[model samples]
Target: TPIKRAWIWHYQRDDRKIFIKIGNILNLNPSVVSRNFNKLERQGSDPDFYAKTSISERPRLITPHAE
Candidate 1:
């Protein structure tokens, strides 16, 4: 659930507001990545696209490299 967790973690961050390119999270084709990002955009809970959590409410989804 890295993708989902990433969305939550990204949502929580307050200092840096950079868009988490789907390419960086998923290993799918560009089309799939774009599609997923777009899908989130269409939803009200679009974490990767719009970041849906406040700093106090964000969950931390650590990247693999860190572990």
Candidate 2:
């Protein structure tokens, strides 16, 4: 459920780029990702949900350079 919780946290934060990246990595549409996150949120009853660890900072994407 940690992954699900993390997705919910990201969705709640309104991080559009993160959702796009998630969709790209998962081979899904960004809207599909958003819809799934919404479904997860509706399934959960926790009103005060927050990530166990602090993640206020945006995630950085690191790509390796080809030699």
Candidate 3:
């Protein structure tokens, strides 16, 4: 679930937050992870639906590295 954990870590950041440097978090293959994270970020569901299926509802362990 490294990727899912990573997503949670990133999700905790507020949009008001901007970074000059993102640090080593991007150590993974960028192209693939970026694509997948985009998929998660794209879930523009209504608050009620999104609330029903919160981040905690995600598969507890997902190591979906494209490599």
- Which segments of candidate 3 are over 4 A away from where they belong? 1-27, 43-67
Clashing pairs in 1: none
In candidate 1 the C-alpha lDDT for residue 37 amounts to: 45
Highest lDDT scorer: 2
Candidate 3 — what's its lDDT?
Answer: 0.31
Give the per-residue lDDT of model 3 (tens digit) for 1-67.
1223433445444442211122124333333344344344554322211111124322222224332
Model 3 Cα shift for residue 64 (angstroms): 14
Compute the lDDT for candidate 1. 0.37
Candidate 1 vs candidate 3: which has greater TM-score? 1
lDDT of 1 by residue, 1-67 (tens): 3455335344533322223343444433444443344345344443333222234323232334443
Sort by TM-score, best first. 2, 1, 3
Off by over 4 Å in 2: 1-4, 7-12, 42-67
Compared with the true structure, what per-residue lDDT tens digits does model 2 show for residues 9-66?
Answer: 5454477776676666555567766655565455453433222222322222221221
When 1 and 3 are scored with lDDT, the better candidate is 1
TM-score of each: 0.32, 0.42, 0.26
